[model samples]
Every structure is written in structure tokens, then in C-alpha cells.
Target: MSLSKLGITGSEKDYQLWISSAEKKTSYPLTGHEHPYGIKMSCIPATGLLQQQLEGSTSASALQEAFLEGPQELQDQFILKPRHSARNQARKQQGKVSDKKTVRKSSLKNWAFGCISRTREVNEHPCLPPTKTKQLFGAPLEDVCDNDTLPTPILDMLSFINHKGPFTEGIFRKSGSIKSCRALKKKLNCGDTVNLNDVPIFVISSVLKDFLRNIQGSIFSASLYDKWLDVIDQGNDEDKIKATQRLLDQLPRANVVFLRYLFAVLRNIEQHSSSNQMTAYNLSVCITPSMLCLSNSGSSENFTKQISFIQFLIENCLKIFGEDITCLFGETSVSSDNSNITDITDNSEKVAGM
Candidate 1:
């Protein structure tokens, strides 16, 4: 049959036809001129008519039977089958997919642990001035002051500020010289006697800020930071104070003592707001960053609430933390001794210069 009869428009030379015999035989070239049954085709681009003819005619069925009975090489060329190696390769590809998924999970877990470790570093081991004693900057409160009191550097700085900072303009509001602050911190850390009289007032203030900021976990510990902000959401002053007092009670004794002492000093500064221009609100704003370990994820409103909480503590210095301060220090009375607080002055003398 002609190529046109096979519904193929190609030249006769473009196609090859083979006839499979019942008897095993070597291959033979196509004549391209005759139709034959039991013919196995190769390189035929159009198989639609060929398939239809095979299905519809008895002779085509005989051709298919002959094709199956022919040599194995003829069968291998015409048939498609899955190879054993191909299935094994598919299984290996599936294992690789599973390995990628495992790696992703492992990477995610490592990232989470890394975040946790960084947070712990910030909360537990802040960068601090080199010191010989374990009870100085960046030390835990329990280790630094088990008797429920401020650390040496903290009390010294607070005492100095209480003595001279009240009259200084922009006492805590102004930034101090960085070099001076570092020098003072090194002196204090080295257990050297530092007379507040010798250091510049601004540097003294900056050292105080640094001390608070670098304290382990901050004065308001990281665990209590959220509760402090929640105090601002209270409906009234009484409720807020009540909430604050509850939170204060939850603090370690050293933190409570330091807070009371620090606020008392700040309260003294607020009393001289006319001269220093640092009111309770301004003092709160000045020291809030140092006193709290604020997270970068916190909103501005949360910061505002923290400042409000601190401002409340300053304004009511005697009311909120007063009794605890009294119990801890064994004071006979509640007094704002700006010139000579007994505990602070006594401690100051140990580190004070001639």
C-alpha cells in the first residue's frame, strides 16, 4: 500500500515497515510497495490508522500474534516497559526529598534555640565593667546583696547624686561625657576609693545610668516587665498602686531595696525640679530605659506605660515601697534625708575620698 493509503503524507523512504514471521528470521528491508499481514512497523510517525486497522481486521489480529511470536529483538524495539534500575532511582529520589524535609526541621529548631540563648544572655549576663568582686555590676541580686540592699556602685552613685545632683541643671536629662563615665566605672569596679567631689556631676549621673542599665536582668526583672506594664491598665490610682505593690512584693529583696532607694533619690531630685528641670515625669523618662530591660518587639505605648509606672513610683516614693524600705533598713522613721541618709552615707564613707 502507498503512504497515502496509510493516511501518512511522508515520502515512502521516510518510513520503514517490517513483517514478523512465525519462524525466527534475520531482518529484511521494506519494499514500500506491498501490504502485508504480521508486519511490525518502526519509525512510522502516524500510528492512528495503523492502530485502528489492527483492532478492526482479523488479519491485523493475526499480525499482532505473529509480532509477539517473532524474535525478542523485534518485541524489545516496539514495546515500552519499566526498568528495574528506574524504580530504584525513583526510591532514591524520594529519600532525598525526605532528607530535605528533615534538614528544614533541624534548621528551624536550631534557629529557635539561638533566639532563646541570645535572650538569656541579655537577661542574665549583660556586659559590665571588669571587677574583682562577684557582688558588683552585672552580678545577681542574691549574690550581690543578700541582706536586701543596693550594690556598692549603685548606693555610691545614688548617694553622690542625692548630695549634689539636686541642684545641677538637667541632672539626668543631659548626656554626660562617655570617657569620664568609663573612667569612673573602672575606678569603682577596681575597688578604688572614688570621691564624688572629684568626679564631674554629669559623669556621676551617667555612671548611675550605666549601673542600672547593666545590672543583671534590670531592677524590674525580665519576668516582671510585662506585669509592670499591666499596672498602667488599671482603672484608677488606687488600683494601680495596689497592683504595683503586689508586683513589688514579688521581687527579690535586693531589687525591692534598690528600687526604694533609687526612687527616694529620684524623689529628692524631683523636689529640685525648679532648679534641675527634671520633674518626676522627666526623671522617669530619663531612667526608664536603664531601669527596665525593654524588648525591641515592645510597642511605643508599652514604653509609655513603663514610664507612667516609674513616674507613679517616683511621685509616691514613700507610699508604695516605703514600708519595705523601712523593714529592710530598720529605720525608726520614714524620712527623705537628702543631706544624710544614714545607710547611704555610712556606705558612701567606705568608698568616699578625703
Candidate 2:
């Protein structure tokens, strides 16, 4: 049949009328967008099916029967295109998508937990020296694993999460979701040389620390200060813990495990509080809330509740993964010269041989 015979050059009214008539006769409706006749393209399988059904069908009744009784597979080929199948599969793999602003909210909650809950002892310790203090808080950290440079969009996204700018609602109150985490994961994977899928726990640890350190100070730095202060003023310990746990539960399993290891490692590092000056407490306040509280953010009652949530997280991590924390991540080996020295720290003050 010629292009004009299919009514391709004429108005779409004829095409719509034909579609309307076909739907009334057939059990299943035909599906496709009308194409321009000038593009002489034939999808062989679909065209072949139509040709097979039309051949030797002289009467209208015969043609209708031929089309309706066509092989099930052939009918499906015309009804559903390959591209449509592919698009459906893509949507299925990625569940519901949360908006960028909401996804950033998840990062903000995680950031707050890392900065506020994890490091209480360090902030109050009296003996840390000046340089050590700066190293833990102010100094820019070198990449912990092979100097992997994270892309700028990831950092910008983190800033948005941190309430750095372009603010959104419920910064401190609402928790993140698994859907949001997966969406953010896909975002991080895009254009990334190192795909984040099944990444090593240690590398993830480095990334988490880098993320926590960088979440401070942007255009909207003071953006959520007042709201969080309101949260603090309420002093609702139960509500805060519940909210924090909801955020933690929404995190990917890898992240939950990484946080456990990260906190333990940071605590170990802070054990040398006198030497390194980065006590666990000081580390907790590392993110430095923009709220204009007189005392350091750690002194607030809200911070105390946050610490309780941190303990809860650690307990849950232990319950879930019963392995010893010391053996999991590669431990920093003691120097050969330092091997001969007997460590007389508080935890090891009374050695068995002594």
C-alpha cells in the first residue's frame, strides 16, 4: 500500500476514526504513535506479523478473524514495542524517586548524627595541644584511600543536604528514606570512575569522614539554626531518639556497618586524646552547628539525647554483626621502634605479665 493509502499525509481525524473503529472490533486495543510517512522505516517483526495476517484475507470477516486469531507472540510484538518494554524495566528497577531537596534532607540527618552524636568525650577533655586540636577540627584531610577525588556535584549535593543553601522544610525533624538513599547512590554512581556498588567498607569509611568534615559552612549555613534550636528547646528525648533511629534505619546496610566501624575507629584515635587532642567529644562537635548558642553545641541537652542515639546505634551494630571490631578493618600497625614499649594506658594499665 502507498503512504497516502494509510492516510499519512492527510489530517489525523481519519487516523483517529480508524483507531476508534479498530478498538470496538478487537479484544485488545492497538498501541503506537502515528509516524510520518516520509520516514521509510520498517520494524520487520511488526510488519511481518501484519503481512502474515492480511495475506489471502479477501472478506472483512476473514481479515478480522485473521488479525484476532494471529499468533499470541506476534500480536504482542505489535502491541508492545521493545523500547516500551525497556522503559518499563528501568522504572521497575528504580522504585519511587524522591526529589533532590528531600534526598538532601537524608544527608543532613546523617551529617548531624556523625558530627553531633559520635564525639562527646573529645570536646570536654582538658589536655589536647593546639596542633592536634586543629588537625581534628580545622585542617583539611587528605584523601584516606588512594586519593580518590570526589566529583563536585556530590559535594554540592552534600552542601544542600547540610543546609548550606537552597533550603527545604523539616531539616532536623523529618528523617531520610531508603528510597532517597538509593536515589542518591545512583546520583553518585553517575560519571564516577569508581562505581559505588559493593564498594569496600574501609573506602566507604574514608568517604563518610570526608563528607562529615565538608558539610559545614555554605550560603545557607545558618539556614536551619533556629529550627534545630526549637527542637533542642523542646527537650523531647524520646522523640529525638525515635527520629534519629528512623533516619538510621533508612540508611543502606553498607552505610550502617560503615558508621559502626567509623565510630569505633574514631574512638580509638581519640583514646590518644592527650597526644592527638581529638577527643571523642570534640569530634562530635566537629560539624559545628551554625546556631548561636553560647556554650559549645555539645553542652546542650539535645546533644545528650543525640549521644544516647549513638550508643543505641553501636549496640544495634554489635547485635547485627557479632564480629570483633578490632579485626574487621585493617588495624594500623604499631611501628617497629614502638613495639618494645609497654603500653600503660587506662584500658591496658594492668598488663597480665606485670
Candidate 3:
């Protein structure tokens, strides 16, 4: 049939009647609007299906089988020409949609347990971190394994998991869920449902410290103050343990790159003591909160909690190691030589007799 035979050019009433009739027979949602030219829209899939069904029957010998046996009034109503995105798109793109602003709400559980939950969801990766190619994910390994850069997925997984664990559970278990935390955060009429029964608030607060530390050392600087600013917005690793302690003291709630150098210093100590297991365990306890904090990368509570934990550690480290041997760990510094050389030789001779 020719385009002229479809009666596509006509008054708006003629087009509306056809649209109404097509919609009744089509399963696909149908919509049309008058353009400056004429009614235009993409063809609904159902329209073609209807045409095929019609062509198969004897009564409608072909779509060209005009209903000669029926009333002549509706004869000029059939038309087909397609244009436009979709009706839903029109409602969204055109100004016909509602004016109220839409706000998104996420789960409080996401904030609290978000990191771990997300990690568990994607655990199907075959090779995890500590593998030969760990650096690809920006994962902070103490020593490069062999000769690989890292698989991209492994890096992503490590980056996500190592965020500062201490922060995740600390904030999550307290708030119940990530959504609840955000609701409380936005002041959007949230109800009280924070849980703190069995979980120790201090441990959670400590994990937050690790989060603070990782963010802080991500820069190159001399002054603690500059490093302070680099991290203060998120938090400072230097005083994570301290800030964490202070926050803990307050209300009962609460809350990388350099890590290679950290591992080196720790390794030196282990070599002297002939032990690595205890050191690893101690560190695991120290850094778990940080990993947890990273788990909820969405939570700012992770930042605060991390800062305090690091601060507490620094204070304790000073007391634990003392001012004398503490300075030995710095990169470009040297220890003072002792003046008791003769006394040391005499001690060696005395020990030989035993």
C-alpha cells in the first residue's frame, strides 16, 4: 500500500481515534502527543503483532482487507509513523512531571556492615590478595611478592576490604544499619534504634583510628601540622589512638602508603626477637578496626573513629617504647653512640669465664 492510502495526513481528531483503538488492542503501553508537525511516536511492538494476527485470518484477508462489511465512518482512521524516545522518557524529560525534589535513602546497615557485607557478596574471585600481583588494586603490601603488578579485581577487593575495618563494625553495630545512620545524620526524623549490647564500643572506636591513619599518611610532608591538615578533614593517623580514646571518653558511642615503612621497622624488631607470629597478631588487632572502617567507605563515622584510634596508639606507643629507642625508626636519623666502649669489652671478658 502507498503512504497516501494510510490516511496519515488528517485532522488531530482522526489520529486520536486511531491511537485510542490501537491502545485497546495492544498490550504495550501506548502514548502520543501532538508535535508542531503532527502526532509522532515510535511503533509499539504489539502493533506489528496485531497486524500479523489480522493477516492470518480469512475475515481479515490482509491488513489491506478494509472492513468493507462494516460501517464506513471509521475507514480513514488507520495510520502508522514512528518518532520520539518513549512516553516514560517524555514524562521525565518534559516539564509535565511532578515538581517535588526526590531524595535517596540508603540502609543504616549499609553504613555499619556495608564494607564486610559488600566484600562477602563478591567473594567469588579465585585469587585474593597477598598474591603475586596485589599492587594493581592499590593494595598496600609490605613487600612486593615476585614480579607481578596485580590483577585489577584483587586490587579492588583489597582496597575495599582494607578501608579500616575498625570503623565499619564500630559505626554499624551502634546505629543498627547504614540507612538509620544517614537518617540520623540528615536530621530527617529518625527513630532511636542504636544497638550496643555485646559489642564493645572501644574496639569499634579503635578500628576508626586505623581509617584515620591510612588517610593521613597518603601525603608527602615534613610538618606534623601539614600532615595534620592533610588528614584533619578526614583525620590524622599520628593521633588516631588518642582521638579515639577522647571520643570514647565523651559519650559512649563511638566510632596506607607509609604502611610499607611501618612493616619494615616492625620486621627489624622481629629479626632481633626471633619471632614474627606475635608481632603479626598484635598488628592484626591494631589494624582490624581500620579494615572495618574501610568496609563502610560510605560512613564519615569511619573517619572520626579512625582518628581517635590512631591517637590512642601514638600515646600508648610513646609509653610502651619510651623516648630513647622510639626515634630509631625514622628514615634519615641515627642513634647516639654510647661512651661505655671499655666497659662493654670488660663485660665480654667477664662473660667468657662463665
Candidate 4:
């Protein structure tokens, strides 16, 4: 029942793994965890959604109908499965089993294939849209994996940090820009208690880390970033094609294809920076180090080049995930052992002006 036992006081590494795995729909048991009924250990759900998809109920066309007609609560309950898992499960249920051993082998093969597809989907389209071209998958926007849109406030803050923005020159004008908390509160139309940390910086940081991890296969690997940086530096036709092929091999086809177009747009932005009254270098620097954890370099120039691609990533994310990307932030209330982890969004209905 202790906080330490629940992993609140665990080593920073363990805490991060626990969190990242949770995002991937993997379970981690919290020993000595307290439930409302009594003192007991608890395991996280095997799937991100609390409920399972009903038989023949989660198809793209079906999901779209449900989204249009179903209640918000119902929408929240629906779970989207990877295409590979769905196909394999269908095959297993339909195929004839010759023997117990054969069935076991089939199951093992299906599991392995399913895992490969799952990893591919995550790495390629960590923020894929519910619908591809004509059908919808009914994915929920509450979870970071399923959700793609950056919150307006977070976008504002990022713009603030970068100086130049997707839309504006940001909160700071020129260089030295400081305002009192009171002045900021009034300007931003926030309460006295609101601070920079009050924004969901942690959640945004976590999402960025997850995205990078999926693409690179491991956040600890410097080689992946270095290779990417090399591509940026070289910028030759042959090198670009080779790098594009490599990424397409690793990522989802849709993502790879979309990114091609995205990069085109970014290139145009860089080329016509003078028209927009902002230099390409300045524009790039404002968005680098996509997340705090991925801050691998101290050089602004290098970070600037790296950030150009991520800008497209974030903008594309908005298209994939839809607009609502509300995440929980702030303190937890722990009056009892049975208490659930509190997110500020839990009370969103009651909290006005959020």
C-alpha cells in the first residue's frame, strides 16, 4: 500500500520504462497495490482500452457509423486492433487444427507475425488516423498513442520557446522578454496558480520520446540520429532516395508516403523563407530537440536542421489524431490507499475555462 511499492519512488529508469511500456499497451504489475475493495496487487490492462472490441464490431465502416451515432462514452470504449493481429486471429479461428502440437505451433507463428506488424505500425505511424481513405477505425483521442493533435496551449508554449511560430513570432519579442507572473496570468487569461509547468509539458515530452523510440527502435541508440543527421547534411539525390527507402522499409507505407509530401512542404518553407519574413535556419531552430529527452546536441545549427522534419511530423500528427488532445496534468489526491491516480482532465467537465 506504500507509494514506494506502487513504484512512485522507484529509480528514474524503472519509472520511465513502466510509463513507456504502459503507452504501448503492455502491463506491469504493481505489487502491494491498494484497490477500492481492499488491499491487493493490481496489474495494468493488457490492452490500452479498458474494454475489448466486440466481434465484427470494430471494422472501419462499422466504426465510422458508431462514431457518428454512438455516445462519447461508447466511443471511448471501442478499441482498435492492428490489421495483422486481426487477420491472424481470423485465420486461427477458421483454420483446422491437425493436432495439439500443430495448433500450438500455429498460435506461436501468429503471435510472432502479430508482434512484427504491431511494431511496424507503431514505428511507422505512431499517430495514424482512424480512417485510411474511406473507412474509420474509431480510435479514441484520450490516449497519447491514439491521439495526434497537440493541445492549443502546448502549441502556444512551444511557439513561445522557439520565438518564431507556426503562426506567430511567439510570446517573446526580439530577445530579453520577461513578464511578472501576474502580468502573464492576465495576458494569458489564466489564474494566479497557473505556471509554465501547469501546461502538459510532461505529456508532450513523453509522446515525443515514444515517437523517437519507435522510429529509432531504441532511444539509447545514437547511431540512428547520426545517420539521420548525415542524410540532412549530405542532401544529395542518391542519399535522399537511399534514406527514403530505408525509412519506408521500417515505417508504415502511409507514413513514409505522407512524409515525402511533408518534406516537400518543409523544403518549400525553407526555400521561400524570405517571402515569409523568417529565415529557414531561424524557423528550424525554433522547433528542434522535438522533445526534452531527445536533446542529444548542444549545437543550435544541428538542432535546427533536425527540427525541420519534426515540424512536419507534429503538423501531420494533427491531421491523423484529430483536434482534441487533452492530457491530465497536476497533483494527485491520496487520502486513502484505494485512490486512483488523478489527472486534471478527470474533472474537465466541472472545470470551466480549461
Candidate 5:
């Protein structure tokens, strides 16, 4: 058979040599009637072109490029086969899975780091020990003093502010020097006698706020927080006042005494609103957060009501707390103090009489 018929450009001697080498390297039959490797003889031109490039360059890269640049039929027969397509799809899926795992790990790492950072911050600036806090700042009113009287530090600070802070502009609204406040706190915590008169008016005000803020259960008590908010939602001022009075009657005697004293002081300050610019409303706004254990989920409307409730307390201090000679520092027992008490006193008496 002529070598040219097989698409070989070489002499018969070269074709014989090529055929001998192919027979040794491959298991394909080389009969002239059929193409080796089961391909059709008519498609030999594309395969023949790839073979020619491989013969010209003995490099494996050139051989691969030849197959890649060959005709579509040749490419489909070799590189684009079903098995290769499946393998490529598997690799792409694996890469996507790896990417998602990497992203999840990164997010988890960031979350862990954030939690650790917050923990460190808390450790670095931890709150005072419970015993120390109770000693220096607050305890339950009943636990600390007799006759529903204020804690010593609280009473001292309030009395000083009452005497010197009423006419001070922005009494509770303004912040004092942080350094001074801390120093005063340190002194108080150490059981050192702190003369409020020697401290700045703003500092004394700030210390009082700090005291209330650090109190164990807050002045109003957490159990009563929702009820206090509900008091503001009452239909009218009359109903609201009555609700507030009932709530006040529910307080532990110590809280009632402290509340009465604190509101009396706030009312006194509000009376000097012309000079201080801290009206009952403003005082309420300034004092609410410290006095109440605020809820994070509470809406702005609830906050407004909280402020309004506080404002009402300040505006009607005597009516809500009643007028007891022993409300502040009096040593009279709860039973004996009832006679001088007014609206709230009447309700408490009714409850007792019941």
C-alpha cells in the first residue's frame, strides 16, 4: 500500500519505520482495511496534523498543544470526553465547599475574638465587690439604716446638694470631673470621712448619681419596674397619682423613706428651677436612668413615660409620699409615723385597717 494514502508525507521507508514503532508501543491493530485505535480513516487528517506536530517536536508540551489546537472532533475524542467533564465538575464543587468552610471559620474566629475582647474589658475594669459596694454606696434601705432613713453617704451627699446645689445651673444635667468623682468614691470606699462641702457642687451631684446607679437593686426596685411604667400609662393625672401612691405603699419601708427624702430634695431643687434651669421634667430626665433599673427592650415611649413618672413624683412629692415628720431622718416607727402622712398614708392605713 502507498504511504501517502495513510496521510503520511514521508517516503515508504519512513512509513515502514513509523508503523514498526507504533506496533511495538501500542496494542492497536494496524490493518490497512481499518484505522488503528478504532477511529475512522476519513478523520485521519485532524489526527494526522497532531501526529505531524509531535514528529517535528519531541516535547510532551508540544504534543499536548497539538491535541488542544486540533479539530473539534479530535478535541471531543480526547480532552472533552465524558470522564474528564465529570472530574472537572467535581474539582469545581470541592473548591466551592472549601471556600464556604474558609468563610465560616473566619466568621467564627471573629466572633470568638470579639467575645474575648469584651471579657477582657470587663476584667480590666470590674465593678466593685458586692460587700464594698454595699458598704460605700448602697444596700437595701432596711438593711442599712433605721426609720427608712437614707444611707449615710447618700444622705450626706443629698443634704449637701440640697443646701448648696439647688441654685447651681444644670445641677444633675452637667457631669463633674471624672477624676474628682473617682477620688471621692475611693475615699468613701475606704471609710474615710468625705465632707461634701469641700467637694465641688457638680462632683457631689455626680457622686450621688453614682451612688444610686451602683445600688444593689436600684432605689425603685426591679420587681416594681414594670408597675412604675404602667403608672404613667394610667388614664389621667388623678388615676396615675393614685396608682403611684399604691405602688409607693408596696415598697419596703426603707425604700419609701429614702424615696420620700430623695424626692423632697428633688422638689426643693425644682423649686429653684428659675435659677438652675432644672425643672421637674429636667430633673426627672437626669435622674431616671440612675434611679430606675432600665430595660434594654423598653421603647422610647416607655422611656418618656419613665421620665414623666419621675417628673410626677417630683411635682407632687408630698401628695405621693405623704407628709411624715419622720420621712427623712425621723426615728418614728412605721405605725406611729402614719398620723402625719397624707394621701399615701391614708391608703397605707386602709390596707392596715383591712
Candidate 6:
């Protein structure tokens, strides 16, 4: 049998874990004379022992054991006092007391080298995990949604502009301060809540000449586009092919809700934009014009009209059966082909996440 079978496979690294463990167990990172791996620690002469074990010895295990058992001279070579001293004395020179511990330059170099080796080994191992960027959601769309959900301009408005009053110097910094989130969250402690199913609708029972004229075939989400067709399929098959002059003219109060909601989100951000993205853009996705119109005209007629319009719109949306219906409250919609009439009458999902 090869002598290697009886010998320790050794290196400074091989000893490191052992040394550190011993230190932790014994409360001292002691090495050499009392170390468990070697044997001649008590018997061999210092100079001869180093040479014999490294290049001259044949009986490896006995040599290692002897090195441990009688390595008396080595004790003084590293210690601050005579060979029999149990600990090193230079430790006091380094201004350490008690279970004094320190890291040396050599130790750090070894640590970095070992880290690099392990990482390289891991890279070579196909089963190892690839490095990744952390995100709240695993999917990129969700990440994008998390990142760019509300536009930057909108968040700035809520945090700064709207909250800023004459007495509010540095309002964003003041209210969005770390402390504010705590106070606000405490006041708004979360509880399971029934979502409000309130949405004012706008019923346009006419040929949307106004919208067909204004929108230039820009909308692309296939599901939403399908829902738009279903909405058009609406209002009395008896009301089909009816005439209108312009796009906004045929649209319900879409523009009004976009403007108001934009303003509300802005108020939360504390920025006042005389012109908001949704509010300022006369051209928006098809829903924009209808929602805007419902919000603009004032009077009980408007409120009654708004409620009737939302109900009608929701009804048409049920025919399409989609998540876009939830978009009325800025929530993500689900995929369904035919929604139930009672589904929308409940309106629970409509108010969720608000």
C-alpha cells in the first residue's frame, strides 16, 4: 500500500479549518506543538524537523506525529519566551490581552485566494446557480411594473408639489422622510377590507365618428383591443350604425376620470402639474376620452349620468370578460372570455389594491 494511506494530506489551508475550529472550541487559535494532526511536535530538532518532513522523511505519519509531540524548540521560535511557554509572548507587544486575536496579512491573502478558488470551482460546476439580479418578482414585466408603475413625474408631484404649502419648506424631504412612512402606516394599519365597487360609467350609444377620427390605430394590447370592440358592440343592437361627428364627441366622460385620477396620484406625490400626462394628453387610449367627458360636466345630471355610464360600460366590459375592467381602478385584470353579470354587480375586485 502507498504510504500516503497512512499520512495526512496537508497544506496551510488544510490546517486552517482545523485551527480555527480548535480556536473556537478552546478559545485560542493555537497551532504546532499541541496541534492534533502532527506527531513529532515534541521530539525533533527545529531545523532538522523542517527539512526532514518537507524533503527528507519517508515515514510520513510518524514524522508528522513526532513533529507535533516534541517540537520543543519551535515553541520558543514562535513564542515570546522559553520553549516550554504555552503561548506566544509577542502577543503583549501587539497590545493584546485576554483571548487576544488578530488577523495577519498572510491570513487575508489566504482567505481571498480560497474564495477565488471556490468561486471558480462553482463556475465550473454546471449544477451551481448562476449569479442573478434580485427583484421582487421573478418576471421582468413584473419588475418593470414594479419599477415604472407610476411615472416618475407622477411620483414627484405627490411627494413634493401637492404637499408643498407656503409653510412647507422642503416638503418632500419632510413628509417622505423615513419617519413619515411609519406614522402613516401606523394610522393606516392594514386589515382585510371589502373593496369599493364604485365606478361612474359613460354610455355612448352612437357611431363613434369622433373617436374613429381622433384615434389613429395606435392601441395594441390584443386583450384590451378585443374589449374595445366588445364595448363598441354595445348599446342596442338597435342602436347600431348610429352617427356621431367626432371621436371625443361620441366618447363618454373618459377624459374627466383620467384627469382626476392623475391629480389624485399627484396629490399623493406632492407635485402640482398644471399639465399631467393623462390630463394633458387630449389623445389617449380609447377609454381616455370617455372617462374625461364624464368628469368634466358639473351638476347632479353629471353624477347620475356618470353612474349610468359606468354601469353601462361595466356591462359591456362583462361581455368581453377581461382584466381591463379592473383597470378602471388601476388594478391588473385577469383573463376570462365571458364574465358573469353578477361578477361585475359585486364590484369587489374593482376596488381591490386601492
Candidate-wise lDDT, in order: 0.61, 0.34, 0.29, 0.33, 0.60, 0.29
**Over the stretch 1-354, how does candidate 3's per-residue lDDT look in tens digits?**
222333344443322222212112211112333221222222221335334445454342333233211223321123332323234433563352233223223353422112111111123344465535222112232222122222222222222222222223222223234443333323211223333223333332332333224432221111232233233344454454454334323321111223222333333333222222323334434543443234324455645544443333333443323333222222222122211111101111111121
- Alpha carbon lDDT of residue 268, candidate 2? 44
lDDT string, candidate 2, 107-207, tens digits: 32332112111211233345556552122111222221112222243333322222111122222222345454444444443534443333432233334
Q: Global lDDT for candidate 2? A: 0.34
Could you give candidate 5's per-residue lDDT for residues 77-124 as a string of tens digits? 222112344455446655444333221111323321121111112343
Models 1 onward score TM values of 0.55, 0.25, 0.20, 0.26, 0.53, 0.20
In candidate 2, residue 107 scores what lDDT? 30
Q: How many Å off is the CA of 293 in candidate 3?
A: 14
Residue by residue across 1-354, what tens digits does model 1's lDDT show?
434433444454444443322121222222334334433334332433334335554463444443323335321122111234334544665554433322111132332112111111133335686765653666666667635645566676777677667777799888778988888888887778888777888898888888778778777888888888888889988898899999988888777767776776788788878877899999999999888646663688877888888898888777886634323222222234334333433343322110
Query: The CA-based lDDT of model 3 is what?
Result: 0.29
Q: Between prediction 4 and prediction 5, which has the larger TM-score? A: 5
Output the number of the TM-score-best candidate.
1
Off by over 4 Å in 2: 1-210, 213-250, 287-304, 307-323, 335-354
Give the runs in model 1 whose Cα sits over 4 Å from its true position: 1-135, 323-354
Ranking by lDDT: 1, 5, 2, 4, 3, 6
- TM-score winner, 5 or 6: 5
Provide the lowest-lDDT 10-residue window in model 2.
345-354
